[model samples]
Target: MYYTLHQLQIFLKISELQSITRASEELHLTQPAVSIQLKNFQDQFPIPLTEVVGRQLFITDFGKEIARAAEKIINQVEEINYKTMAYQGNLSGRLKISVVSTGKYVMPYFMADFMTENKGVDLIMDVTNKSKVVRSLELNEVDFALVSVLPEKLKVDTVELMPNKLFYVSNYDRKFPKAVSKKYLFEKIPLIYREPGSATRNAMESFIEKNNYSVHKKIELTSNEAVKQAVISGLGCSIMPLIGNKNALKNNELKIIPVRGLPITTTWNLIWLKSKNLSPVAVAFLNYLKDRKEGIIQKKFSWIEDFINV
Candidate 1:
């Protein structure tokens, strides 16, 4: 039942290269050594394998099938080896992560950089709204989640990475200043708010309730992109994460509300079950994150320097 991998490699190389000379060159083996390995393989397998047509040699149908199976075995062996090495160093398993839609702008910057250094690690991701990000972690559908609100009374550990300041953005033509009181900010602008039950909506509502401020009449919508488009068209002003419309801000399509207290400031946290058994790969990535626990943005993302401890 056991066969030498060298012999199997020899068979596969020969089957693929066809010519003995070419297979030998491809394997960095002398022709005679290639021949001997194939001979060993044929003797061990319970079937005919090689034949000659004039001066050319060929493998039988069963031989080619066995060669294909050998490829699978080699692939599996390599996968195991890479995983083992990655795990031993720190990270080496499938790490499933979930994040709020806004994190689509932030998390990948860090995740990709870390993964680039860990050759053996693999990352799986799900991006959704903030509420679903928390639910996925609580339901164990994902190992970790990036979200704005940290769930209380849950057996989870959270690391705050950065401050995501919500800004009231409008076209510069609106002539809003850089610092406005909470009362003045809400009273002046027509609000373009996120949909009811949305995480952003919940956060905004809590802030408004705590301050006892009445917001001006405004439109409510679901899609972040749509909201940005509305703001660009000057349909009205809306509050959004800096991460949410960093591009629009950069492009000068919209500007922050001059009144500073109108929007709000919040932090983003990475959450995971306190008692979850992390795979080696996941652990490697997590540890790497702890070291860089600040936050990451795209190469040019402006958030890296924003976190005091990062």
Candidate 2:
């Protein structure tokens, strides 16, 4: 009954992490300071909130319940702050978005100006595989989902933002003829692939099937950076998006192979469920994208065109 919000916050952090040490590191407080706060917080309650055995710290059942309550309290407090800012004619709230891995390259550029203008807004972006991004969108867990491939099952509205071009790339040192054959690239060359659930992998598979090319799958990687590094290491070539490979292509770490029907293209879209009501911040972001997407692409992503054309 007599606990401070600071104490509740510390306890909540400790409960979530189950480690005073880790909670301190995340909270930017010294271990001793966190320990003192946790002890003070525990003193006000009659029941045990946490326990330690061997080397592991555990939050008790009651502690977990309290942590849930604490989270609600914190969220409510944030809402109050946002409401205060809104009353002053400022758009203020958390803007949450989940993006497919390749989307990391594109979404941030779109968000940068909006975030700079709205200081009161909090941006939470999760960069994950396509399946997870789609799941987040399906659950309405995020305000928007950024992806190159549209989910087939979701009834969603989308704002088309930019072109996502996929191309075959190899180590810069690898030699290719002026006009490379798709059959040679797929059947002869060892090809790196992304893991199954990746949008890039789906795109690559679709291309291979469409062309009836039997690919030699050399290695499978989970992320774009990994696939890029693998190709750079001379492991194999991959069909990768030009957006993520610009620096590599520019620096000659990787080279685009000019095969026929190269640079498979898709539009990067910001999608939200049609049934989900848009929050003020979410609506503002959509409006911002409508007004500024072309300009943002022209400024930040125009370089990608050169790579795609190769």
Candidate 3:
């Protein structure tokens, strides 16, 4: 059997998108060209790679197995290219990181300088919830994971980055006393909550449980942005990370309520499993963070200290 790397690439893209048209669009090729290549690729194997049902394309089980192998091959090829660049005295490789949703606001600032200095490095950052982020780290799918809360069961080493403060905030239009009691806020006002497995949700729950307060559950949202929008729309107040609320708070779209024991504080950390070997790109990034994290926090996030004080 004979197959080219281009064929493997096309098959992988087709499997990922499950639509020839979409794969073509993403690959920057015409639909006819993509279909022709896909047909040629499939001809090299006896088993069917894909099936169409009611005009919707779906990769078959066999296709999925092939796609997985194709991905490994492509990654290896990319690594070979990166190695060549490294030999030429250029830093080049893929850097994959999985971060909790709120970390999206903070991690980019830390990465901006490193990414600028390393032009040949390809950064693949996934912004997701805590459970998925942890899972990615556990499976060694990503070089590192950014989170406010450390996973209890995973034995990992962490580099502390900065403070993550959670605040109880409501729509600016909502009227409240200068200092509302925690009991009143929890018992009377409806509280929007992040979904289970979110670090923010875990923090909020711990605070409420500690204070022996019972909250009125309004609705559950999946992301920090969604929860912020809900609060801004006056749907309900929510306990949110200050990082995700800076813009809304600055614009007076949301207002933080003053209460004792407010602004739950946690440290943002970059974590990796102790057992995994660090790639050159990952080690460079870790070194960058170790050397410059304090400066980045001072420059980009000094405003957070001022906001919390007020």
Highest lDDT model number: 3
Q: How accurate is candidate 3 locally (lDDT)?
A: 0.91
Q: What C-alpha lDDT, on a 0 to 100 scale, does residue 252 get in candidate 3?
A: 95
Error of 1 at 124 (Å): 1.8
The most accurate candidate by TM-score is 3
Q: What is the lDDT of residue 97 in candidate 3?
A: 94
Instruction: List residue ranges in candidate 3 displaced over 4 A.
Output: 1-7, 17-47, 177-179
- Which pairs, if any, clash in model 1? 90-284, 91-281, 92-280, 92-281, 93-281, 177-258, 180-259, 180-260
**Candidate 2 wrongly placed segments (more than 4 Å):** 1-58, 176-180
- For candidate 2, the per-residue lDDT at 33 reads 98
State the displacement of the C-alpha of residue 23, model 1, in Å, after optimal TM-score superposition.
Answer: 39
Cα-based lDDT for every prediction:
0.74, 0.90, 0.91
109-182: candidate 1 lDDT, tens digit per residue: 76877888866666778878767777788888888888877777578887777777676677656655566566
| TM-score of model 3 (CA atoms) | 0.89
Instruction: List model 2 lDDT by residue over 47-141, tens digit each.
Output: 98888899898988988998899889988999999999999999899999999998998899999999999999999999999999999999889
